[model samples]
Target: MNIVSQEHQKSGQQPTEQVTYAAPYVDIEPAESGYVLRAEMPGVNRNGIQITVEDGNLVLVGQQQPLSVSGEALHRETRQLSYRRVYELDPSIDADRISARIDQGILTVNLQKAENLKPRRITLE
Candidate 1:
């Protein structure tokens, strides 16, 4: 099983302001039933995440809430960061059974194998 990440660019108002999305570090674990994916997404709320499956790919999007400041800031590291990561899903994975949840800035995605891909037992003839 292999999951590949592709870089994507986000259009900005100004041509010089083009921003490239940062892919969060992910941890994948294989299981007998399927695979478990864990992604680190700090400062992202539950409502800020969007998960979708399209064209044999799993897409993960997270929008960090913009920081509010009454006075003008002299300097800042990340003004408003957004996350966009896409993973190529294997054909054996059942997209319909996929589920995800976020807890303490950690996103967990459960990928279940297709019914036909599961191991079966055969009776002795």
Candidate 2:
């Protein structure tokens, strides 16, 4: 997995765009038919997450918006930020059949193996 870093640019006294990024932890497990990938992305909503597979890479982007409260807080620990992680996909992966879902701050992706790559058992009579 690859972690993309935050980028900065300036143009003639314009306000600099401050970006805070974090890489969510991930786990990949192999199955008989495919692989299961799970990522921990706390504070990310449905609209705040994006998953895309392109150029033999699976990319995950998640964002956490700032909390909106009426009163000021005495202490603060959370910050609005974005999360990005990328994984290089092998030729055995069937990208067209890949599926993903998010629940309870966790993102799960099912990566199906290509037909020829799946294990097969042969019987001899």
Candidate models: Cα lDDT each: 0.79, 0.79
What would the per-residue lDDT of candidate 1 be over residues 1-125, giving only the tens digit for each residue? 22223332343234544455667778999976899999887778899999999888899887777766799878877535677788899889999999899998899889999999888998999
List model 2 lDDT by residue over 5-108, tens digit each.
63333234544665557888899999768899899887887898888887888888988756678898898775456788888997789989988888988988
Pairs clashing within candidate 2: none
In model 1, which runs have C-alpha deviations exceeding 4 angstroms? 1-20, 69-75
Task: State TM-scores per candidate.
Answer: 0.74, 0.74
C-alpha root-mean-square deviation, each candidate:
5.7, 5.3
**Model 2 Cα displacement at 32 (Å)?**
2.9
